[model samples]
Target: MGAAGQPWSYIQRFPTEAGVPRTYELPVAAFQPVGMRMDPAPQAPAALDPSIITEVSVFILDKQQGPFAITITGIDAES
Candidate 1:
């Protein structure tokens, strides 16, 4: 399910340093075909500039029968 809001515009509020516009696209997990047992290939992560990212946000736009969660992790210790 894709979002309907203009969440991408939020990136404009950050300190990009660069004058050009930018976009942030979330990667959706892959779905396997029937009778397939092997795991799908891994994907390269988005190249993000840490110094420009000050905050993040998530939104659940539609109604759901059960609770949902979004977890953000895996930051470098040196940061």
Candidate 2:
């Protein structure tokens, strides 16, 4: 899907529920591995629940700044 003229998409797992929807703001520049810190300053962080992140999936979107990937890290809910 496209948000605010920007190309974006989302992944939804099974067993949906009706609870307070949460929003996390992850910078498009901070999806690198822990050892790969290109910039001296910190990059954008993800908004996923700390207890539910197990794996991360990256998606690339076409933009003027070239293609950018948004990584969605899965967290463990049993924290």
Candidate 3:
């Protein structure tokens, strides 16, 4: 969960296919900050700092007891 040796700063969870392979595009603004909401009122999340994102991870939450495989074809930073 750490990025570039720094504590997890942002995260986003989404559903994905079990076996089928596909690509996912994540915009910079889509990731929410990781922490308690200090503000009592709702507010928009801050933009993610792409420079600090030195790594990318894909975690499978399926609880089936067996070996699992996940293939990440590529990771790109787009404007």
Candidate 4:
């Protein structure tokens, strides 16, 4: 999926609605954790919500230009 040139951010959290997902860009810096203090400060603090979390994605909020490189670990396919 692609988006229109949004500035880089960190720790974007989402909520699920009836098995559907809602997505948005966090206004915080690209280095701040969701639950910790953010630069320029958000009105409300952030935290992880596990109940309605169906999927969580860690990605750069930039245009999905080609030739992207990503690496993920902590897998147990044999289980």
Of the candidates shown, which would achieve the greatest TM-score relative to the real structure?
Answer: 3
Output the worst ten-in-a-row residue range by lDDT, candidate 1: 30-39
**Residue-wise lDDT of candidate 3 within 1-79, one digit each (tens)?**
2256443356676767678888877777777666432222123236677766766656565567978877777777786
What C-alpha lDDT do the candidate models reach, one value each? Answer: 0.32, 0.32, 0.61, 0.36
Worst 10 residues of 4 by lDDT: 1-10
**Candidate 2 local lDDT, 1-54, one digit each (tens):** 112321222233222123534445454333322212223222323222333344
Stretches of model 3 off by over 4 angstroms after superposition: 1-6, 35-45, 62-64
Give the per-residue lDDT digits (tens) of candidate 1, residues 9-32. Answer: 121112222345444443222211
* CA displacement after TM-score superposition, residue 3 of candidate 1 (Å): 20
User: Which candidate number would show the highest lDDT if scored against the true structure?
Assistant: 3
Question: Ranking by TM-score, best first?
Answer: 3, 4, 1, 2
Structure candidate 1, residue pairs in collision: none
lDDT score for residue 36 of model 1: 18
- lDDT string for model 4 (1-79, tens) is 1112322223544432344433444432333333223243243234323332333355544555756554445422121
User: What's model 1's TM-score?
Assistant: 0.25
